[model samples]
Target: MTFLTLLLQTPAAGGGFLQFLFPVAIGLVLYFFMIRPQQRKTAEAKSFRESLVKGTRVVTIGGLHGLLVEVGPETVLLEVERGQRLRFDRNAVARVAGNPAAEGATPTPNA
Candidate 1:
């Protein structure tokens, strides 16, 4: 009928506008929920790498745990075992396990 056709025509432009907004809304949601968090974590990791110091205990991205013997501009010297050392990029360090400032941050359970 003519009335049905007229109603459908009017809704088409409005539906198109909604469709245009959808991808934009998805982009924003992805940015906030996924992209923003990753950026912040990367910033944190970079700062931690820059602040690394000798004599600190750290874990690497490859699961090697060691004492930081030297902190270079782009590399670190780690003592992984008795009389054995290894070299790695600064970014290879994942988290500091024995930072003096982070020590005692959590209370140990009394057994």
Candidate 2:
């Protein structure tokens, strides 16, 4: 009876209640700062991959640079080495290299 009362009144050694709570607090902190942000970034990347279209210049996750020649439902055709085409999943594109359509404004060929 006395042991039960002591056990209820006091936590065991090694910081008792605080020890149990510490790991949980750390986990929550990691989730908020690390895990949650990573999940959000992954979702954003997925959305970006879904929204990609043909004729867009893009960089691959493997550092291959190319222009998006065709966009399929799940894959894409990339013109990497000037007339050399390669295929990859849409999600394999790390980022758009540059908007070629937006850079058509040239300051005269003479300049």
Candidate 3:
């Protein structure tokens, strides 16, 4: 067969296995690189939310920064200004102040 004709011809064997393996490899790559890191971030955020306590300074997902005045089971009260408090759902908290890792910084071994 001419070089051009040989190049155009499909593989006669192992093509099906190669096709299956390609997609499986792609899935594993996506899971490890994308999905797994996202899951870890979500778990860390949830843990941070659950561990909140009064007197912790936090920033909300909406960019509102305040001191946590009260941490309730389903919500938290934030003191934005002197005598000015706002109540928000617990999930609204994005990260605690002074924690670079929680604010999307590269996580360290001690973080």
Candidate that would win on lDDT = 3
* Residue-wise C-alpha lDDT for candidate 1, range 1-111, written one tens digit per residue: 999988888744457778899999999999999999999998988888888999989999999888999999999999987858999999899997765565558856972
* Model 2 CA lDDT for position 5: 91
lDDT of 1 at 87: 96
Encode model 3's per-residue lDDT on 1-75: one tens digit a residue: 699898789577666889899999999999999999999999998898899999998999999988899999999
In candidate 1, list every pair of residues with a backbone clash. Answer: none
Against the unseen true structure, what C-alpha lDDT does each candidate score?
Answer: 0.88, 0.88, 0.89
In candidate 1 the C-alpha lDDT for residue 66 amounts to 87
Which consecutive 10 residues in model 1 have the weakest lDDT in total? 98-107
Q: For residues 22-62, could you state the per-residue lDDT of candidate 2 as single tens digits? A: 99999999999999999999999889998898888899999
Against the hidden reference, what TM-scores do the models get?
A: 0.71, 0.67, 0.72
Q: In angstroms, what RMSD does candidate 1 have relative to the true structure?
A: 4.6
User: For model 3, what is the error of residue 32's alpha carbon versus the real structure, in angstroms, after optimal superposition?
Assistant: 0.8
- Better structure of 1 and 3 per lDDT: 3
